[model samples]
Target: MNVGFRVHQDVLRPDRALLEGFAGAAVGNLSDAMHGLYTMDSGIRPVVTPAARVTGPAVTVAVSPGDGLMLREAIGLARPGDVLVVNAFGATDRAVLGGTVLLAARDRGVAGLVVDGAVRDLDEIASLSLPVAARAVTPRSGTSTAGWGEVNVPVACGGVVVQPGDVVAADGDGIVVVPADQAAAVLAAHREVEAAKGRPSDLASGGEARRSRADVVFHRTRAAMAERGATVVPAAYHRWPVPPGPTAASRPDRA
Candidate 1:
């Protein structure tokens, strides 16, 4: 199998600070900030829970599924703070990245990794503290012998077309790609949107509005029973005496 390996040496990169700003930016807001332009699929999820957010300029790789040679090479070629965005043909049956590859990226100061394929060695990767987002996880390891791959080229990952130097921003919500040239503009737009939305209300302040599952069910059941001609006494009013044969203004609390 003559797997042709292609490397584009003159790949363009965005400014480091721009990438950092996107990294620190909200992933949800970034997706909105893109205006439906280039959001990755939601299928790609963090392998480990409580995953850290990753943001950096993309070093795109187009590779055959179940192969890791190109990925390993990409890691070495990627500069510090670069995120390797890999198109693995959406093959999740075999692992494309694992402990060794992750450690290599971490040691090189690579920002993170996003793969449209499966990965393994979760325990090792979890301990390494490197941010990773992928389609799935499998125990099967991939072969590095596959020689066909292209580095620093436009590729598709998680159903999104990614070009070299595109900003890859990922967090709990998933991944969003911002074109290299549009990074600054998108960042600015996201900040504007955030400001316009205003600060979210604190959960503590809304505790009175929160209802448990059982409470909700009970209220719904009471309504249904009332429709059946059954007299319904709401829990709150049950403890008190009927006041003046229930004035029209004294309706029971429905919530």
Candidate 2:
């Protein structure tokens, strides 16, 4: 019997300038602008203090639900601006990564780590000043079962299928995976969305006004699509309905 272990050494990435464009942009904006084409699920979040954003080409690893072997290998394989994306089946009881691994990744110039499972040593990891996004934290550590996983493979992280070289842009809003081939096109669309709406004065702002605005944007987009015979389903982001009286035609000014 033989185990199938593979690693893709060469993966094409988007231009540096394109990735840099996503530096401070909100992950939600990118997902909304792309019409949720590559949005990751919402459970995963940052554990580090003073949460930082990350944008880089992906170096994907597919491992067992509670294994860290492949992730450790991925750190070595990752490039300076690569985000190590691990598909760990969202297991939370056992931590697949910890402070030591994060420290090594930092030394290797890895941009960030996104784990669908759990991670340990949050305090130490925060001290390293590395951008890390994951589901949970625990004291139980995973076994180093090497030779059982694959690298640079298409892996599902936070419910999104991430392929090697796909651009990953993540922040407190969560992670967004953009196909490597669609990086430029998606970046352009993201720019358009930002330009049309401008950056929110404060992402932390909360009120009925914000909710109403979101609903207005959703309905406006839906109405525009309805005119073209395309029906658009409302996304999860819209927590409220459009206010009375303003239809798509009437809300063209709001976006």
lDDT for each residue of candidate 1 in 15-124, tens digit (9 for 90 to 100) = 76676676567788878777866888889998887978888888988777888888888888888888889888889888888998899989998988898988899998
Give lDDT for model 2.
0.84
For model 1, give the 10-residue run with minimal summed lDDT. Answer: 197-206
The deviation in Å at residue 243 for candidate 1 is: 28
Residues 1-255, model 2: lDDT tens digits: 234467776667778887887788788889987898788887898887567888899999888867777778888888898999988888898988888889999999999999989999988997888999889999998866653778887888888899998999988778899888888888889889876675676334678656766887898898988889995466655567767887777786865
Which candidate number has the best lDDT?
2
lDDT of each: 0.81, 0.84
Using all chains and alpha carbons, the TM-scores for the candidates as numbered come to 0.75, 0.76
Collision count of model 2: 0
- Backbone clash pairs for candidate 1 read 3-147, 3-148
